[model samples]
Structure formats: C-alpha cells, structure tokens
Target: MKAAVLYARNDIRVEEKAVPALEPHEILVKVKATGICGSDLPRVLGDAAHHYPIVLGHEFAGVVERIGFGVSKVKVGDRVAGVPLKPCFKCQDCLSGNYAQCKYYSFIGSRVDGSWAEYVAIPEINAIRFDDSIRFEEAAFVEPSAVALHALQHIRFEGGENVAVLGGGNIGLLALQWAKLLGAREVTVFDIDDDRLASASRLGADHTINAKHPDVEEQVKRMTDGKGFPVVLETAGSDVTMRQSFELAASKAKICFIGTPAGDITFSHKQFELMNRKEFTLTGSWMSYSAPFPGREWELTLHFLKQGKLNFKELIFRTFPLDEINEAFDLYRTPGAVKGKLMLLPG
Candidate 1:
C-alpha cells in the first residue's frame, strides 16, 4: 500500500507502507475519494503543531474491501461514509450525548492515520452505510456536511429566519445549503473573493456581500430590514470576520462560530455592550458527535443529496491523484483559487 505521509512542514511524500491491519469490530475501506479540508493546510505547514509522519484526510468515502470480526452494520462491498470521531462512551460528556466534549475524543486524519492512502481501517461504529447510488466523491463530503449540520443544530434557529454566513469556502457554502434546508427564509453570504461569493450564490445564498467593500455591515443591515440577521455564522476563521460577526447580528439573535481561528482576537467593549443589551446568544460548534441521536443530521444530509435538494457537485473544483498530493496542497494554499473542495483520488 502507498500513503501520502507528512513528515514536516511543506514536506508530504507518497511512500510505500504496509497496509493497515484491521482490528476486531473494524472495517477496511478501499480509499476512493478524499477531500482536503482547510484545517489540513495549517497542519501541513506545521502551524497547527500536529504530530509528524501523519496520514492527513478525514473527509473521505470508499468501498468496504474487508470487514473485521463482529462488524454487522456493514459488510464487504458496502459503500460507506463515516464520522471520524472515536469517543469513550462512558465519559460524562459522552453519557450526556455530548460526544464532541468527551475527554478522550479523537479524530482520524488529525491525530491518527487517515484516508490519504489506498486503504484505512475504521471502527465499524463510525461507518455509515450508503447505497451504490451515492458516488464516492459525493459521499466523501458527508463529513464536512455533517459538520455544517452540527453547527446549525447548535444554533437551533426558528423557521423563516434570516442568516448571514461569513466566508464562502466549503464549510460556508455547505452552511448556506443547510440553512435553506432548515427553512431559513434568506441567507446572505459574505466573502472577500468575488468567485467564492459567486459559488456561494449558486449554493443557495439569497444575497452575497464582499466584505472587502465599504459599508458591508450597513449593506447587510439594509438587506435584513435594518434589524440585522437573526443568525450570523462565521466560517472564515479570520479575526476580522469574527469581529464583524457581532456587529451584523440582531438583538436576541444566535451566533454560531464554526471556523477555527488560528490566533487570538480582539473586540471592542461596545460590541460586548451591544450583545448584553440585545440578549444575544453566542456559541461555538465543533465537529459532529459520535453518539447516535434521534434525528441523525448526517443521515438527513445524505437524504437531501440523494433527493437532489442539495447540489455540491459544482463545489468540486479540482481532483488530483494521490501522488500529486503536494501539488493539491499548493493549489489549496494559494490565494484566489476559488476552488471549493479539492479531491485526492486513490485507487
């Protein structure tokens, strides 16, 4: 087996490695398509300070080539997309259905070897069985789409509410689509790049704003009847956008921060005063929980894709073979690419 191993910053090599051995209750997936997320870039640059010599890819989907003992949820030849989080279910947070908060929570790609290879061994518990109708490229998106859904669920918006999503990257675009699916009357997406803003419009944003332009906040306020959006989601992970998020949200509105900012942020005292006066609810949402809930949002996202309600095919801007993983990373890190999601295909 061959895997793209990251040994240090800007040094990812495709090296031959022994195929991962499957553990009992685990399944071996023949990697088909894997998406490079924004987080992968920082880790690759050594900015995120992750362990070296790691296989980096969590947003992935593939065919089940083999199954471990007692793996009954899926069998050989089944198509699957999985939640990467593996948690100890006995922890207090896990027992309370907060799997993301579990002290022992860890994910593939970041902490462990991920899907940047010909094969990966995943616990059967994280795998979600899908039919052959779903393409591996589309199924590979289920992980990030699940993250978007989890953010939306954390906010708990009412029907017919307006939303402003800052950033037009993959997560922001997915958040726009999920907001519509959840019955948001209007979604306004903000991005500095015109191309990304255009992509966001195609994904289902009612309005698009270029944050680099003057009076952006005023423009957003006017679009929302001068009351500001009830829900403002920051997905850019920039300090500028994070600061502006508070200014664009209405009184008593809910703000969900989905992007991971790389460094500390500074805000005005007046912004906190407004939040207090408006009784605003500020929250941060991380990755999806592993524990089963009554309405699995990931399953719902799959259903939406299956029904043609959510179209993400256009979001895929480029695909590269696993051997060209470094080139793919270069393109991802470059500015003005406007590429939504880059897929690494492994055969």
Candidate 2:
C-alpha cells in the first residue's frame, strides 16, 4: 500500500507502506476518498504533529475489504465513513457517555496512522455505514459535517430565531446549513472572502456579509433590526471573528465557539464587557461525540447526506490524487488559495 508519510515539518512524501492489519474488533477499509481539514494545516506545516513518519488524514470514506473476528456491525464491501476518535471506554468520561471529554482518548490521523493510504484499519465501532447512493467524496465529509452539527448542539438550539455564523469555511458553511435545517428563522454567514460568502449563499444562507467591511457590524445590525442574533456560532479561529462574536450576540443569547484558536487571544475592556452586559450563555465546543459512542452528530450527518438535504458536493473546492498529497498541502501556503474542502483520492 502507498501512504503519504510526514517525516518532518513541511515534509510529506507518498511512499510504499505495509497495509494495516485488523484486530478482533477492527476492519480493514480500502480508502476511497479523504479530506484535508483545517486542523491538519498546523500539523503538516507548523511541526504540530505528535510524532515523525506519521500518516495524517482523518476525514475519510472507503469500502470495507475485510472484517475481523468480532466485527458484525458492517460487512465486507460495505461503504462506510470512518470515525477518528478512539476514546478509552473505561474512562469515567466515557462511562458517562461523554466520549469527547475523555482524557484518555487517542484520535486517528493525529494520534495514529489515518486513512491517507490505500488501506487503513479502524475499529468496527468507528465505521458508520452509509447508503450506497452517496458518493465516496460526500461520505468523506461525514466527519466535518458531524463536527458542525456537534457545535450547534452545544447551544441546545431550538431554532425559529435569527442565527449568525462567523466564518464561511467548510465547517462554517455546514453550520449555516444545519442552522437552517434545524429551523433557524434566518441564517446569516460572515466572512472576509467574497468567494466564500458566495458559497455560503449557494449553501442556503439567508444572508452573507463580508466581515472585512468597516460597516459590517452596522450591516448586521440592520439585518437583525439592532437586536442581534439570538444564536451566534464562531467557526473562524481568527481573532477578529472571535472578537466580533461578542458584539454579534443578542441579549441573553446562546453562543458557541467551535473553531480552535491558533494563538493567544486578548480582549479589550469594551470587547469583553459585551458578554457581561448581554448576559449571553457563552460555550466552547470540542470534537463531535455524545452518549452512544460516535453519537447523533455522526448519525444525523449521514441521514441528511442520504436524503440530499446536505450540500456536500458544492463544498469541495478541489481534489488531488494520493500521489499529489504534497502538492495539496502546498495549496494552503498561498493566502486565499482554497475556498472550500480539498479531497484526496487514495485509490
């Protein structure tokens, strides 16, 4: 099998490697498609990887080639999407059905070899079978879709109120769609890029704002009649958008920060004071998971994809063959190089 092995910072090579063997509860998947995630950027370029000579990719889908002795949930030839989190089932958090909170969790792609190769072995429990009608590329998006859904679930969203999503990246776009699906009276997306904002509009966002504009807040105020959004989700890890979130929230609103911050953040007296004045319920969301292992986040993502309610195809910006993994990583180097998801065809 061939895998993209990262030997050092900014150094990734597609090389021959032995195929992974399955454990009793594991299954061998012939990886068909995988996606490059935002979290993968620093690990590949900033020396953030856990170790050297690692295979780094987690968002993926493939066909089952073989199942181990105890595998029963899925069978050979079943098309499935991979769940990357491997929580220690015995941990107190895991026992309490808070798998994402488990301190003893090992993530695929980041903590171990991931689906960046022709063949990868994963626990059967980590595989979510999808309808055959769904394309491998769409199935590959299940992980990110789940992440977007999980973020909104943190706010206990009941919809019918105005919602604001800060950022128009893949996750942000998905968040906007999920907000609409969950019954938001209106969903607005904010971003610095016009192309991304256009993508948001195509993905069913009721409104899109270019956050780069000096009067962006005024525009938002007009859109919401000055009350602001009752639900605010910040999916751009940028300090600018993170700071803007406080001002975007309505009084006593529910706000969730889903994007991971890349650097230290400091707020001014007036900026931080908004939270105190508004009395909003601010929360931070982690990786997608809940009570029953992989949880409803993963389940609902697949369901919506199968029903054609989710727009997975339009979110893909480009696709590269596994042999061109290095080139794919290079695309991220150029400012504003990618507008949406970048996919990899391992087969």
Candidate 3:
C-alpha cells in the first residue's frame, strides 16, 4: 500500500506500507477517491493532533474488496463511504447515538490510521453503501457535507428567518445551501476571499459580503431589516470572525459554531454579558455524528446529491494521484491560492 504518511508537522512523505488487515465485523475497502479537508491543513502543516507517522485521510469513498466473517451490510464490490469516527459503543453518549460526544472517540486520520492509501479497514457498521448514481468524488464528499447538515441540527428553523454564514469556504458554502434547503428566507455568506464569496453566490447565497468591508455589520443589518440574522453559523474559525459572530447575531437568536478556533480567544466583560443579556443560544458543533452511527447527515447528503438538489463539483478545485500528494499540499498551503477543495485519488 502507498500512503501519504505524516511523520510530524511539515513532514509528510509518500511511502509504501503493508496493507491493513480487517478485523471481525470490519471490511477492507479499496479506496477509490478521497478529498483533503480544511482541518487536514493544520494537522499537516502545524500543531493540530497528538501523533506522528499517521496516515492522514478520512473523507473518502471506496469499493469493498473483502468483508470480515460477520459483516453483512455490504459485500465485495460494493461501493461505499465511511463514517471516520470510531466510538466506544458502551459510552452513554454512544448509547444515545450522539457518537461525537462519546468519551472514547478516536477519529480516523487523527487518532487512528486513515484512508490515505489504496486500502482502509472500516467497521461494517460505519459503512454506508451508495449506488452508481453518485460519483466516487461526490461520495467522498458526504462526510464534510454531513458536517454542514449536522451543524444545523443544533437549532430549529421555522422559516421566515435569515441565515448568516460567516465564511465562504466549502463547508460554509454547504452550510449556506443547507440553510436554504432547511427553509431560511434569505442566506448571506461572508468572507474576505472574493473567489469564495463568488462561489457562495453561485451556490445560492441570497447575498455575499466581504467581511473586510468597513460597513460589513451595517450591510448585514440592512439586509435583514436591522434585526440581524436570527440563525447564524460561524464557519471562519478565526479569532476575529469568532468575535464578529457575536456582533452579527440578533437578539434571542441561535448561533452555531462550526469552525474550530485556532487559538485562545479573549472577550471583554461587556461582550461576555451579551450572551446573558440577549439570551443567545450558543451551541458548539463538533464532527458530525448522530444516532444510527453515521445518522441522517450522511443519508441526507447522498439523497440531496442524487436528487441534484446539490452539487459541489465546482468546489473540487483539483485532484491529485497518490504520487502527487506533496504537490497537492504545496498548492493548498499557498496564500490565497485556491478557491475549492483539493482531492487525492488513491492509485
């Protein structure tokens, strides 16, 4: 098996390794397609996770090459995508189907070896079979798309309210579409990148704003008739944007933080008191998971893609074979050099 192994920060190498063996109730999947996630950037180029010499990939689609003795949900030659989190099924959170909240959760590509190579072994229960109607790349995307959908589950949408997504990246764009699909009256995406802002518009943002604009807050208020957005998503993951998220949210509104903060954030007492004064419902969304393991997020992502209600190919900016992973990383890390997702095809 060939893999892009991350030996340490700024030290990923493409090398050969033995194929992993499948455990009982597991399936050996011949990876057909995979995509690099935004989270992967920090893990590869900066301090993100606690491990060395890890195979770093999880957003993937594959074909089953072999099934363990007890596996029944899928068979050899079946096309599938996998839920990357391996939970301790005995935990209270796991028992309740909120697997992301499980105390002993180990994520593929982070806490465990992942599908950066020709093969990856996944528990049969984590595999979701998809038919030929969806492309391998699209199937690989279900994981991230599921993240977008799962974030919304933290709040209720009774319609007639606007949605504010504070980033125009892939996840932010997906969140924008979902806000519309889930019944937002208007969707506005904010970003500093012109290209990503344009992509957001093409994908159905009712309005796009450059977050760097001096009048960003004023424009947002005007767009929402001075009430601010009732439903807000902070997907930019920066200290600056995290603070602005509070500013953009309306009184008594629901705000979901989908982006992981890169550093410690300092807030003034006045800023902190707003949560109490406005009675804001602030929810922190982690990696997507729910009851039934992969849950409705994965099912709905595939369903929407199959129905042509969604399309992200425009967001798949580039595809590299396993041999060109180094180049892919170089390109992805270049400042303001990209507008879409980068994919790695397992050979």
Candidate 4:
C-alpha cells in the first residue's frame, strides 16, 4: 500500500508501506475520499506542530473491505464514514455523557495514521454507516459537518434567533445552513473573501459582509437596527473577528467560538468592556462530540446530507489521486484558489 507520509514540516511524500493490520475492535476501510480542513493548514505549514511521518486526514469516508474479529455494526462492502475518533467509554467524561470532554482519545488524523492511504483502520464504535445513495465524495464531508452541528448544539440553541456567522470558509458555510435548518430567523455571514461570501449567499445567508470592508460593522449595526444579532458565531479563528464578535452581538447574546485562533488573543480594556457591558455569553467549542461516539452531531449531519438539505457538492473544489497529494496541499494553501474542500482519492 502507498501512503502520503509527512516526514517533517513541508516534507510530505507518497511512499509504499505495509497495509495496516486490523484490531479485533476495528474495521478496515478502503479509502475512497477525504477532505482537507483548516487545521490541516498549520500542521502542513510548520506553524502548528504535528508528529513527523503522519498521514494527516480525518474527514474521510470509504467502503468496508474487511472487518476485524469483533466488528459487527458494519459488514463487508458497506459504505461508511469514520468519525475522527471514539471516546473511551470508561472515562469520566464519557461515563458522564460528555464525550467531547474526554481527557484522552485517539484522533485518527492526528493522533494516529489517518485515511491518507489505500486503507485505514477505524474502531467500530467510531464508524457511521452510510447508504449507497450518498456519494463517497459527500460522505467524506460528514466529519466536518458534524463539527459544525456539534458547535451549534453545544450552545443549547432552541431556534428563532438571528445568527451572525463570522468566516465563510467550509465550517462557516456549513454553520449557515445548519443555523437556517435549526430555524434561525435570519443568518448573516461575514468573511474577507467575496467568493466565499457569494457561496454563503447561495447557501442561504440573508446578508454577506466582507469583514475587511470598513463599513462592515456599521452595515451590521444598520441591518440589526442597532440591537445586534442575538446569536454570534466566530469561525474565522482570527483575533480581529474574535473581537468583532463582541461588538456585533446584542446584549446578553450567546456567542460560540468554534475557530482555533492562530495564536494568543488579547482584548483591550475598552474592547473587553463590550462583553462586560452587554453581558455577552461566550462558549468555546472544541471538536464535536457526544455520548455514544460521535453522538447526535454525527448522526444529524448524515441525515441532513442524505436528505439533500445540507448541500456543498458544488464546492468540492478539486480532486486528486494519492500520488498528487503534494499538489493538492499546494492548492489548498494557495490564497484565492476558489477552493472549498480538497479531496483525495486513494483508490
């Protein structure tokens, strides 16, 4: 089997390696498609560190080629998507139904070898079965979409509030659709990329504002009649947008921070005062999770994709074979590439 192995920062190569052996609790999946995520950027770029010689890809889906001794939830040849990880049922967090808070878990893409090769092993507890009707390409997205869903659910939303989403990247775009489906009165998206903002508009944002524009804050104020959006989601992972979230949210608004900021973020006294004065309620969301492995976040995302409700297929951007993984990363790192989710076909 051939795998794209990251030897070091900026040194990823496609090389032959023995196929992974299956564990009694695991299943072998013939990799069909996998998607690159925003986090993949820092790891590949050397800004954020990752273990050397890793096969980095977690947002993936495939067909079951072989199942280990104890696997039963999925049989041979079943189409499925593997959750990036599974929690230890014995952990205090897992036992308490807070799977996301599990102190220790094996993350397929980062913690272990992932689906950037011909086949990857996944624990049965982390596998979600998809039907033949869903395209492998679409199924590959279940992971990230589940992350978006988990963020929203973590906020304890019951719907009918207006939402302001900062960042129109894949996660932000997915957040817009999820907000609408959850019955948000209106969904507004903010981003520096007009193209992404356009995609957000197509996806059903009532308004799309380029965060770089000088008038963006004023425009948002006018749109909200100075009251500000009741729900604010910061997904850009930038200090600027993180602070803007405080300025754009209404008094007592629920703010969800889903993006992993590139570095330390500081708030000036005046800027921090906005949150204090407005009583903004902020929650930081990590990787999506729930009890029973991926929980409802993973399940609901699959349901939405299967029903054709959460559509982003047109943004598949580009596809490449395992051999072209290097080029794929180059394109992904390129600015203004009209790229959405870069897919790899390991075949």
Candidate 5:
C-alpha cells in the first residue's frame, strides 16, 4: 500500500507500506474518498505534536473488502462512513452516552494510522452503512456534518431566530445550512475572504459580512435592529474573531465556540463580566458523540444527506488523487483557494 506518511514538521512523504492487518473485531475498507480537515493542518505544518510516520485522515468513506471474524454489521461490498472515535463501551462516560467524554477514547487519523492510505482497518462498531444512493465523495463529508449536527444539538435556538456564523469554511458552511434546516429565520456568515463569503451565500446564508470591514460589529447589530444576533457560532479560530464574537452576541444570547485558536486568548475581565450580566451562555462544542441510540447525531447526519436535506455535493471544491497528497496539503494551506471542501481520492 502507498500512503502519505508524516515524518516531521512539513515533512510528509509518499511511501509504500505493508497493508494493515485486521483485528478480530475490525474490518478492512478499500479507501475511496477522504476529506482534509482543518485539524490535520497543524500536524502537517509541524506545529502540533503527533506521532511521526503516521498516516493522517479521518473524514472518509469506502467499500468494505474484508471483515473480521465477529463482524456482523457490514459485509463485503458494503459502502460505509463512520465515527473515528473508538471508545470502551463499559466506561462511565460511554455508559452515560457521552462517548466523546469517555476516558478510553482514541480517534483514527489522530492517535492511530488513518485513511490517507489505500486501505484502513476500523472496528466494525464505528462503521455506518450507507445506501447505494450516496456517492463515496459525498460520504466523505459525514464526519464534518456530524460535527455540525453536534454543535446544533448543544445550542438552543428558537424558530425564526437570527443567527451569525463567524467563518465560511467547510464546517461553518455546514453550520449555516443546518441552521437553516433547523428553522433559523435568517442566517449570516462572516469571513475576511470574499470567495468564501460568496460560497456561503450560495449555500443558504441569507447574508454574508466581510469581518474585515471597519464596522463589522455595527453591521451585525444593524442587521439585528441593534439587539445583536440571538445565536452566534464562532468557527474562525482566531483571538480577534473570538473577541468580536463576544461583541456581536445579543444580551441573554447563546454562543457556541466550534473552532480552536492557534494560541492562548486574553480578554478584558470586564468583557467576562458582561457575559454574566447579560445572562449569556457561552458553550464549547467538540466533536460528535460516539454513543448509541436516539441521540445518534452521526446517524441523523447521514439521514439528512440521504433525504437530500443536506447538500454536500455542491460544497466540494476539488478532489486530488492520493499520490498528490502533498499537493493537496499545499492547496489547503493556500488561503482563498478552497471554496468549501477538498477531497483526496485513493486511486
């Protein structure tokens, strides 16, 4: 198998490696399509610490080629998408249906070798079978879609509520669409890049604001009749945008932090007090839950896609072969080039 292996900071190489052996409860998947996420950028740039000589990718969909002895959920020729987090079901957090919070949780593409290769072996429990109608390229979006769904579940918004999203990237765009689907009366997206803002407009955002504008806060306030947005989702992981999120939120509003800053942030204590005085709720949203049953956010995301309620196909900006993995990362680093999502196909 050929894979893009990360050896050091900005040192990824395409090399041949032995095919991964399947565990008793795991299944082997023939990699079809994988999406590059923002989280992968840190490891690619050598800023974030990660195990060297690792294959990186988690947002993916593929066909099952072989199954472990006990696998029953999927069989050969099945197309599937899955949650990357592998958790011990007996743990307290997992028992309580908070798998993301489980102490024994580890994710593929991060803690272990992942989808950047021709094949990967994942536990049968993590896989979700998709109908033949869903294309592999679109299936690659299931992971991010699940994250957007998780964030939506964490926040409380009323129908016809005004909402603002702070970024125009893949997650932000997905958030905007989900907001609309969930009955937001108006959706606004903010970004410094005009290209992304334009893409946001095409994807259901009622309005797009260039945060680079001098009166960005005032613009948001004016749109909301000076009351500010009832809900604000900060997806632009930057200190500047984080502070701006505080300024643009309405009193008694809810704000969800979906993006992480590259460094620490410092804000005035008075601003912290403002949140309390305004009775605002500030929440941090992580990845989707990995538990079973009714609140299965990942399952709901796939359902939405299957029903044509979530339009992921239009959001794909480009697709590259696995051999061009370095070029894919380079394109991802180039600002304003990717309008939505970029996929890597293992040909």
Candidate 6:
C-alpha cells in the first residue's frame, strides 16, 4: 500500500505502508477518488492534528475490494462512499441517537488512518452504496454535501422564507442548493471572492453579494426590503461572516453556524444583542451524523446525487494523483491559491 502520511506540520510524505487489517463488520475499499476537505488544511499545515504519522482524508469514494467476517451491508465490487464518523455506541449521546454529540468518537482521517491512500479499511456501516449513475468523482462529495444538509436540518427548516448563506465556498454553495431544493422561496449567497460568487450564480443562487463591498449591509437590506433573511446559514467561520450573520437575520429567524471557528471570536454588543432583540434561534452544528449511525445526511446526499439534483463536479477545482500529494499540499501554502475542491486520485 502507498499513502501520503503526515509526520508533522508541513511534513507530509508519500510512502509505502502496510494495508490496513480489517476487523469483523469492516470492509476494505480500493481508494478511487478522495476530496481534500477544508478541515484537512489545518491538520497538514497547522498544529490541529491529534497525532503524527497519520494518513488524512475522509471525503472519499471507492470500490469494495474485500469484506471482513459478518459484513452484510455491502459486498465485494460495490462502489461506495465512506462515512468517516465512528461513534462510541455506549455513550449517552449515542444512546439518545445524537451520534454527532457522542462523548467518545473516532473520526477517520483524523483519529485513524484514512482514505488518502491506495487502500483503506472502514466499517461496513460506513460504506454507503451509491447508484452506479453517480460517478466516483461525484461520490467523493457526499461527505461535504451531507455536512451542509445537516446544518440545515438543525433549524428544522420547512422552507418558503428567504434564506441567506454567508459563504460561497464548498459548504456554502451546497447549503444554497439544499435551501432551494428544500423549498426556500429564494436563496442568497455572500462571499468576498468574485470567483465563488460567480459559482453561486451558476448553481442557481437567487442572488450573490460580495461581502468585500463597502455597501454590503445596505445591499442586503435593500434586497430583503429591510426585513433581512428569515433563515441565515453562516458557513464561512470567519469573524466577519459570523458577525454579519447577526446583522443579516430577520426577526424571529433561525441561524445555524456550520463552519468551525479557527480562533478566538469576539462579538460586539450589538451583534450579541441581536439574538435577544430579534429572538432568533442560534445553534451550532457539529459533524454530520444522526439516528441509525451515519443517518439521513449521507443517505439523502447520495439520493440527490443519483437523481442529478446536486452539483458535484462543478465544485471541483483540481485533482492530483496520490504520488503528487506533496505538491498538492503545497497548493494550500499560498492563501486562496486553490478554489472549490481538490481531489486526490489514488488509483
């Protein structure tokens, strides 16, 4: 087996490694297409990884090469996407069907060796079988797509109200589509990058706003006729976007924070008071998981992809072979050097 192992911050290397041994109910997948996630950047370049000498990649799709004892969900030769969350079923949160809140959780690509290799072993329950209509490249997006859907699910949105998505990056774009697909009257996407904004437009965003503009707030107010959006999704995790979420919500709105903050976040009094004044519900969403283990997020993602309702390929910016893993990480060294998704082809 071959893998891109992260020895330390900025020290990832492509090296030979032993193939993972499968346990009962586990499946060995021949890695096909794996997408680099935003969370992976910090682990490879910053001090966010839990351990050294790790193979990092969770968003992936592959073919089942072999199955362990007792595996029944998928058979050998099945095309599948991997679900990365492995929750302690004994935890109180897990017992309550809140898998995402499990006190003890082992995440692939973070807590263990993951899909950034020619072969990886995962639980049979984590192997989601997608329709053959869905390409391996498209199946690679199931993780992030499920993430965006999970954020929306936190609000229990039964749409029709105007929705605002405060980011045009990968997650934000997916959230925008989910908003529209789930029946939002209109969906608006905001970002500082024109390239991202343009993507939003192409993907059916009712409106796109450049947050870098001096009149961003004014434009937002004008578009909503001063009422602001009734549903706001903050997917940027930047201080600016997090604060703007407060400034952009309508009274009695529902707001979900999907993106994880990278540093200390300081909010102004006015921004903090908006929650009280507007009586808007503010919730923070964690990893995408719910009842029945991997849950509806992953299932519905594949459903939509199979139905051709979701845009998967459009979000991809580039792809690299596993041997060129070092060069791929170097692309992230320069801020904004890459846009959309960067896929790794292990085959």
Per-candidate Cα lDDT values, in order, are 0.86, 0.92, 0.87, 0.87, 0.85, 0.92
| Model 5: per-residue Cα lDDT over 250-306, one tens digit each | 998899999878889989998767687778789988888745622467788888888
Expressed as tens digits, the lDDT of each residue in 1-347 for candidate 4 is 98988888878899998898998878999999988778887888774545787988998999999999988788999998988875666788889988777778678988799988999998987789989889999999888888888889999887999999999888899889999999999999998888888889889999998888889768987899999999999988999989989989899999999999989999999999998899989999988788666688889988888888989696687889999988987775667874587889998
lDDT for residue 177 in candidate 6, whole number 0-100: 89
RMSD in angstroms, candidate 5? 1.6
Candidate 6 C-alpha lDDT tens digits along 1-347 = 99999999999889999999999999999999999999998998899999998999999999999999999889999999999999989978999889988879899999999999999999999999986898899999999999999988878999888999998989999999899899999999999999999999999999999988899878887999999999999998988889889999999998899988899899988789999999998999987898887889999988888788999888999999999988888888878888888999999
In the predicted model 4, the residue pairs found to clash are none
Q: Who is ahead in TM-score, 3 or 6?
A: 6
Assess the local accuracy of residue 4 in candidate 2 as a C-alpha lDDT between 0 and 100: 94
RMSD of candidate 6 to the truth, in angstroms, is 0.9
Error of 4 at 189 (Å): 0.3
| Candidate 6 minimal-lDDT segment of 10 residues | 325-334
Enumerate clash totals for all models, in the order shown.
0, 0, 0, 0, 0, 0
Task: Please estimate how well model 3 matches the true structure, expressed as its whole-model Cα lDDT.
Answer: 0.87
In model 3, what are the clashing residue pairs, if there are any?
Answer: none
Model 2 lDDT tens row, 1-347 = 99999899998988999998778999999999999999999999897999988999999999999999888899999999999999999978999999999999898999999988998899999999987799999999999999999988877998899999999999999999899999999999998899999999998999988877889878987998999989999998878888889989999999899999999998999999999999998999998998787999999998888888999998999999999988887789988898899999999
- Which residue ranges in model 4 land beyond 4 Å of their true spot? 47-49
Q: Which ten residues in a row have the lowest lDDT in candidate 2?
A: 212-221
Which of the two, 2 or 3, has more lDDT? Answer: 2
- Which TM-score value belongs to model 3? 0.97
The candidate with the higher lDDT, 2 or 4, is 2
What would the TM-scores of all predictions be? 0.96, 0.99, 0.97, 0.97, 0.96, 0.98
Candidate 2 — what's its lDDT?
A: 0.92
* Candidate 3 per-residue C-alpha lDDT over 239-273 given as tens digits, one digit per residue, 9 for 90 to 100: 87777778888899998999988789987888778
